[model samples]
Target: MSNSPQKYKTEINFSNDWDISTQDKYIFQFFHQQLEDLEANQLHVHGVKLYKVESSIVVTAILRHSLPKKLLLEQVVLLVKNKDGKELAKKQFDMALFGELEPCTARPWKFLFEEADLLVPLDEIENEMDFEMAFEYYEKVISDFELYLDENWSNGLTVDQQGYVKNLVSSLEPIKVNEISIVGFHFEESEQAVNIFIIIRNAFSQALTIENLPIQLFDATGDIVCKLGFPIGEFQIASKQARPISLSFSKEVFQKENPDFSSWKIEMVPQTL
Candidate 1:
């Protein structure tokens, strides 16, 4: 038999050098630090996403617990930067995600920046790493922005001057009933009268007028135990104020079936507009 030359064939495949797990870890850590910073100021950030559109960059995030009681934030500041550790732009959102928010709820927020708003061209950003580094730089500047708001809230609306005018008008307007609450009651046997204490909260910016307010008391079975009316003749409650009122009722007005006022519930009757 004639000797034959040996023949061999081999196949090779190449894998990407990037580690996806490492990228994920970096993103997670960046967001964790952002959340921690927000928590220090009693705010919460749930999620964030970045997108490049044409000549602009859009940032969408979920904000949680952004508003606190007795404080309203009419504007928010957004800072953008480049991978070279240079600030790119700063934008202001005139309105919040919602006009009003229930406590402990999440709301979606969006911030848009155009080419003119950025310091560098979008093409200069090479990869995800560059974008991430820019966002990291933003984290440090946001705290100063928050402090600026605390001190210059009245001037926060520079771009939209109309907002400032509207705010001024609202502050000068009349107050309205925001909430009504019944505190407790005291029965004066010697005076043959029962004094019911109530707290009325006016959330408006201006004073409110309350006149001839009617209140009713009910028993455990929802039966009418007593009825009384308060003559707050021309009484005006100041803006963002909580005022206490005491209504007196004679013992003769109490129903004989439920004369005891110990287990009674009190409520304010709605007034006709």
Candidate 2:
């Protein structure tokens, strides 16, 4: 009954608009219009180096918009919270946007996490872990922007530049405690049950004074065993500050609820400066 030749429809894949090199040229102008139309993009947490002992999240990313020329961005707001969504803390960081005329030229943003503002509770510091890095790009016009990864960046800075900035960063005052130690003890009555000792240090050169640090303890099954701390060592953690702190708890508590204490986390709240 059909006289016409058989026909087929073609499918097409769309690429991210922002990810392309040519897109950068016009991204700025687009951003300008966005500022007028949309609400300020709030990226919760700029740089987070938190541990799993505490339930926390970090928000960080590059917020950009393009048009014909001129790029514009404002500081992004980073927020952290507990599992219940109770706001733990927040930080605001300057937005960095890069535009390139060519594809492979040098266009790197040096990200320096404000070391001093991390306000994680002392109890959460008992576990071993690292901070989570999450970000949201608003007015996401281009598609491929997420693919832009810089393997060359280390500790939030370029490799070579990171090396050069090492001394400069070290010369700066104590930002926050960069390390934690956990010692273990075995009970003679129960060979399988071991009591863990914990010590958190603020090894910075300058003073890192903070208030209301929330430290929560988790069992092997990722349940909140105990949320400790209201009186977080209220003192100035001077640069190169290394001091011993304590956590008093029982292995039986963690062993009874969850045998998997091996996978624990501790997240500290970063301060807003």
Candidate 3:
């Protein structure tokens, strides 16, 4: 439940249009294909990419082998999900079946979810062409990544990034919230806005209700840059089951006091219920 990945790495590619059931099947099919092509003791997926853009989820990973002539694989699977984890559609296939040749586009594995049924970029050459083999491997796997987003029609929740806070709530390991501050700041000479993001952990599982989650700015010497505070509205959670909440600030207010400020140190100024 902690945001920090206990496993080596896991990335999920998702689209908002499909329901969760369709998404589950897509996952099963995609993994099933990889299981088929993976060579004995040679398959690896220590580092992979997963994300959702619009209505589709795209997954990319690197697979290597101990042999010089090992077959390289690329897989592309399309996915769709609804607001509450419903799956609506899915498509998947391998590149080897496509005439055994890589697509000539700048991105070899190119499939726009809106345009085609599915997209798959994995290609295996019988022999190593040269020392530059890895470059081709990466290009094949990574280049068409943006297509995943360009094809879908719905805007889904950025679940993976937002879920990070949930992990903080589930942490069994102790975390030190060394510092937190929220303050106004100007970015790139643009409009003033909240320049800080503060995450306060309820590691003890005790309910914390702070009335004013202030907009704090820190100076070069680690001093408070401004006295202004954001009106963090009422918060509630009576017991240990509560999850951590987040606070947002305006950029202009933060940057006016500390132009260089990017982060903040927050403290719980206690208030009784």
Write down the TM-score of every candidate. 0.35, 0.26, 0.28
Residue by residue across 1-273, what tens digits does model 1's lDDT show? 857543221111111332336565455445544443222124443435667778887764544453334224476655655545566656666654345445443444556777777767777643332432122212211100000122233444364543533333333423334443333333333357666654454554466788877778776677887766778787566655544455777778877554554466677776631
> Could you give the candidate ranking by TM-score, starting with the highest?
1, 3, 2
In terms of TM-score, which candidate is stronger, 1 or 2? 1
Candidate 3: deviation at residue 168, Å?
Answer: 4.1
lDDT per residue, candidate 2, 16-122, as tens digits? 32354555434433423333221122212222233332344333222322223333446544544444444444555565443321211112122333333345654
lDDT of model 1, residue 134: 25
TM-score of 2: 0.26
| TM-score, cand. 3 | 0.28
Estimate, for each residue in 1-273, the C-alpha lDDT of model 3 and write its tens digit: 667523222122332333446666564446434432332233233213334444443444333333323243455343433334333334554645322222110111222232233232212111111111011121121111010111121133265644543443344333323222122212222364434433343323345555555444555556654545545566433323322333444554443454454443434333321
Count clashes in each candidate, considering only residues at least 3 apart in sequence or on different chains.
0, 48, 44
Top candidate when judged by lDDT against the true structure = 1
Q: Model 2 off-target regions past 4 Å?
A: 1-206, 210-213, 230-233, 238-244, 250-263, 267-273
